[model samples]
Target: MSKSIELKKKAAEIRIRLMQMIHKAKAGHTGGSLSNTDILTVLYYHTMRHNPMEPKWNERDRFIASKGHSVESLWCILADLGYFPSSELDTFSQFGTRLIGHPNNKVDGIEMNTGALGHGLPISVGMALAAKRYDNDYRVFCLMGDGEQAEGSVWEAAMAGSHYKLDNLVGIIDRNGLQISGSTEDVMGLDPLDKKWEAFGWHVVSIDGNDIDALIETFDKVPSVEGKPTLIIANTVKGKGVSFAENAINWHHRVPSEEELALAVQELQAQIESLDSKEEPCHE
Candidate 1:
């Protein structure tokens, strides 16, 4: 159908595939994977200038999944883009498989190893700063979790991004609220999140992260300020797209039971069909 509709369909397909991948393996950081899917979909399919065939091309943009536990979603995107064979998804999280729980540079599309939360932004900052030093135009993007924001290293990197004026770096916080333990606010409050980043000298924008159209528009208009890093506070529902899993903290790292998988499949199929009919708000 239309371009926007196509993006929605792509996201649905990725969600379906990633859930299956996790289900087959009987393990994954489920809630965060689903919550972060739409953002990864938009980045790989639309926003980022990356090549599956030449993942390491210097001119290509860089992306890091700092909240590395959610890598099932990223792997789905990379495989669909042909960075590697889709069959490899089946081996995810298995011993002797390259598709480990966390992303490592060994994977074709991965920019670096990242699973120790709160490191993505710092690494991305270094990449973006190096781009500036070399007078290159490549940009760097990092996706993180709200829980990871509690790390002091994140703030240190945030201050550095601002001080260095990394206009080419864009970081997105998957503000899904719920983390593995419980609600992020309950764990460690990050209220006034936007202002906190702004106080650190960032250009912050908040938006519905599940909406593909909103995601597209936001990414297109980033680096809105000159000489500043952009941090998108993406409001998202933990376990987005799965009826039973959505906002359920227990699903943070839980594997879906067969019944739960069937329900998720039914719900996502309905979503895909509805998009085909016209347009509807994606369930958050």
Candidate 2:
């Protein structure tokens, strides 16, 4: 199979694992995790420079899941990549398990403690600036939620990233449209997302976040301009892949019933089967 096809397979499997994690643990940000699964897949499996065995390698690219609530998918990805024992997955969300609801640095591959939405981008800026100061080539990737755009700190960090000309920092916002309370537009208007980023001195690229092929191509074009940070607004469905969950806001923190879980698994199974049936080139 081609590399894109392999990554597609990984994405499907990760979604399955995410669903299983939530279903078993009885806790997780289901919809958001589902929405960002493709982005995470491309970053971990195709893009980014890092070794699972040497996760702390100095030169390796840094990835921070700023919208850390959706980290169930990230946890699954890290385990599959061998950053930690896959067996550790069983303890997820349990009272004593290291795997809690949010992303914590305690996790082998996780770089920061994230869950409170707005702090991720700021932290990423600091990391990127540090890299620039040390004259390192590593790039920092920070994934934020569109709902997180309401945070003032995000914009502050955006300005800092640009002022420092941190071409090494890439900001990816999971513009899935929906958030916990309701639609992002309903909660807080972010209609002029692209223009606002541009005003903040960022080079912006908008893409279909759900499409694996599109995701790969856009990521390949990061830091689209020199002397500026890149912001990719990935338009995605809140709950992708699962019929009942797609665009359904309640799925944000809701758990699926056994029957629902079976159906979700079945749908993703079909996707994996179809991708397995053929090898196709990725880039256009």
Candidate 3:
């Protein structure tokens, strides 16, 4: 299959998994997970270097989901990438299931157990530092929520990354503009977000989070500068892909009802159809 078609399929499968897991678990951060699905898809399926069979490969690229509430999205991607059987996804959030509400390193492909905001970057910096010290080619990719930037640790990590000259670190911010409360601007404006990172001595770029082409291009251009960490301020919408939940704050941790799940699946199918129609035949 063409790369575009494969990516589109992966995105659809991820959306389905997100909705199914949340619905089955009867608990999850639906909005945030859905919002960043495309970004995660791009990384796990197309960009990041990692071994699915050997989840602990030292030379593999590391992905830290800084906004841990979106663990369901990460889990879905990991499963799709064969880190674990897709069947395991059904156990999400259930009692004793490894697929908890937040990521846990014990899981086959999870690099860390994160749920608390603003934690992933620091860990990613450490990982990048280690890779550099060991002279490894691995890259650390950290994904953070826009609201999570409210945490002081993020800035601290940002400074540390630049100070250490950890260009091997790449941070992708899910700038969906809404947290659990209201708009991020209304809650605690992170406007001039790009400038904030730049001021911290990191390189910054912004893109539409849901656009696959833009996502691929931006990630391919990572480590934006020679001596600084790269941050992609991905502009996204909460509850992306699903019409009713798109940008709806209520869906932040809301569980989709049976009816809602049907709608979400239908919407994803439509997206797949749209992509299929536009896909050019792969010559090779």
Candidate 4:
């Protein structure tokens, strides 16, 4: 299969797994997970150097899902990447299941158990610092929600990353605009977000988070500036790829009804077909 076709397939699978997990759990941050699916797909399937068989491989890259509420996306990607069996996704939120609302380090591929708004960036910074000190070439990637950027700890980590010149770390913000309550601007204005990161001495790039081409190119063009961490402010829609759910705050942590789930699955499948049609035909 062509690389584009493979990525499209991976994205479709990720979306299916995410919807299935959330529907079974009857509880999850569906909107945010959907919004960040493409980004996570690029990281796990295309960008990051990780080994499912040896998840604890010391030299492997680390990914921190800082906006832990949206962990269904991470769980889906982890399962797809062989961190765990796809069947385990059905156990999400069930009694004795390790697949809780937030990621847990005890989970095979999870580096840190993060659900709190601002914790992942700091933890990722620490990982990056450790890697640098040990002369390891591994990289650290952290994904934070735009709303989570309101947390003070995120800024603290930003300062530390810049001060230490931890170029090995990269932070991707899901700037999807909406939070649980309302739009992020109304909750807390992050206007001039790129400027803020730039002023913090980090390299900043902005892109359409849902665009596969942009995601692929951005990940390929990492280490934005040597000696400084790179932050990609990925502009996204809250409930991406689903018309009714898109930009709807109600889906933030709401369980989808059976009808809704069915429709969502159909829509996602259609999207996959559309992507397939757009791909250039492979020569025999």
Candidate 5:
């Protein structure tokens, strides 16, 4: 099977796993997690060079989940990658479980504790700057929600990233449009967001966040310029893959009922089967 096809299948499986985790926990940022699954899948599986066994390896690339509410997808990916026991997923959000609703630094493979809006980019900037100061080659990746753009700290970090010329820093915005309330534009106008980033002196690129192939291609060539931070505005559906939840604001943090979970899984399983069938046979 081709790498793209394999990643596509893996993304579908990740969506299914995240949905199951949310359903079981009865609390999660459903829409956002679903939207960002493809981006995280591409990063963990293909882009970032990190060892699951060595969670604190100094040379490994770091990822900060800036939009920390949507952490179900990340937890599932971490477990499946052997950073922790896959069985630990069942205790997500339960009493005493390290797998909380948000990304926790206590967990293996997690760089920092994040839940409050607008803090991730700043921390990521520090990590990236530290790398440059120490002459290390590690990169820092921060994933933020488009809604989180309203946070002033993000822009501050943006300016700092450029001023320091932290080309090793990559910031990705999950531009799903909808947030906890409603449309981001209605909440806080972020039109011409790309232009604003450019004005801050960072290289920006916009692409389909749900397209695995596009994600792979884009991540492979980072810091496209020699002395600027890279920002990827990943346009994605609010609830991708699942038919009923797509673009539905209620699904932002709403727990899926038993019936809804069943239907969502059915749709995702069909996607996995479709990708499996598309694999070309190998010949000697």
Candidate 6:
């Protein structure tokens, strides 16, 4: 199968899995998880270099989930990739489960514990700078929420990334527009966000975050400009894939109802089947 098509199928499956996880646990940041699924899919499956068998391998690329509340997708992806047992998903959000609402560093694949906004980029900058200092070549990829852009610390890290010329670092904003309370603009205006990053001395690129093909292509051309950190403003829809939840603010932390879960599964399953059909040979 073609790479992009495979990624599309995988992302649909992950979405279904995340939705099921959230629905079963009766808690999750549903909308953001759905929005960032494609980005995570492309990174874990296609872009980043790492081994499930060696989650802490010295040479492996690092991924930091800055917008950690929407961790259902990352958890499902990590398990699906064999970083941990898929069965553990059942314990998500349960008492004493390693899989909590936010990422835990105790998890094999997680680099840093994150849930608080604005910390990811700074930590990622440290990692990238460490790579330079120690002469390690592994890149650091940090995924941040657009709402998190309001945090002043993000710009501090942005300046440090550029000042240090950490081209090995890549920052992606899941620009889905909604936060836990409401739209990001309603709470904090971040228009001209890309420009702000550019002003901070990073190279910025904007693309449709939900498009599998676009994600693949964009990630493949990382550090498109030498000597600067790369920032990808991934424009995405909150609650993508599910008909009822797409772009709906209430779905941000809202767990799907039993009925809503059923419908979402049906829709995502259809997407899986559609992508699967494209892989079959045409019969003349």
Candidate 4 lDDT for residue 73: 84
Stretches of candidate 1 off by over 4 Å are: 279-284
Candidate 5 residues 15-111, lDDT tens each?
A: 8988888889888989999999999999999999999988889999999999999999999999999999988988989999999999999988999
Q: How accurate locally, in lDDT, is each candidate?
A: 0.92, 0.92, 0.89, 0.89, 0.94, 0.94
Task: Please provide TM-scores, in order, for all candidate models, with all chains considered together.
Answer: 0.97, 0.97, 0.96, 0.96, 0.98, 0.99
**Predicted structure 1: clash tally:** 0
lDDT of 1 by residue, 123-234 (tens): 9999999999999999999999999999999999999999999999999999999977888999999999999999999999999999888999999986679999999999
Candidate 3's C-alpha runs over 4 A off are: 280-284
For candidate 2, the per-residue lDDT at 69 reads: 91
* Error in Å for residue 51 of model 5: 0.4
RMSD of 3: 2.0
What is the C-alpha lDDT profile of model 2 across 40-155, one tens digit per residue?
Answer: 99998888999988878999999999899998999999999998888888788998898899997888899989999899999999999999999999999999999999999999
lDDT digits (tens) for residues 1-284 of candidate 4: 66756786777778777887888888899899989988998898899999999999999999999998899988888887788988888999899998899998888889988888899999999999999999999999999999999999999999999999999999999999999889999999999999999999999999999887799999998876899999999999888877888999998988888898899889889978877777758689
List the pairs of residues colliding in candidate 5: none
Which lDDT tens digits does candidate 3 get at residues 187-226?
9999898998999988899899988888988888876789
Give the 10-residue window scoring lowest on summed lDDT in candidate 5.
274-283
Model 4 worst lDDT run, 10 consecutive residues = 1-10
Which candidate model has the greater TM-score, 5 or 6? 6
TM-score of 3: 0.96
Judge candidate 2 against the unseen true structure and give its global Cα lDDT, from 0 to 1. 0.92
TM-score of 5: 0.98
**Reference-based lDDT, residue 237, model 1:** 93
Q: Regarding lDDT, does 1 or 5 come out ahead? A: 5
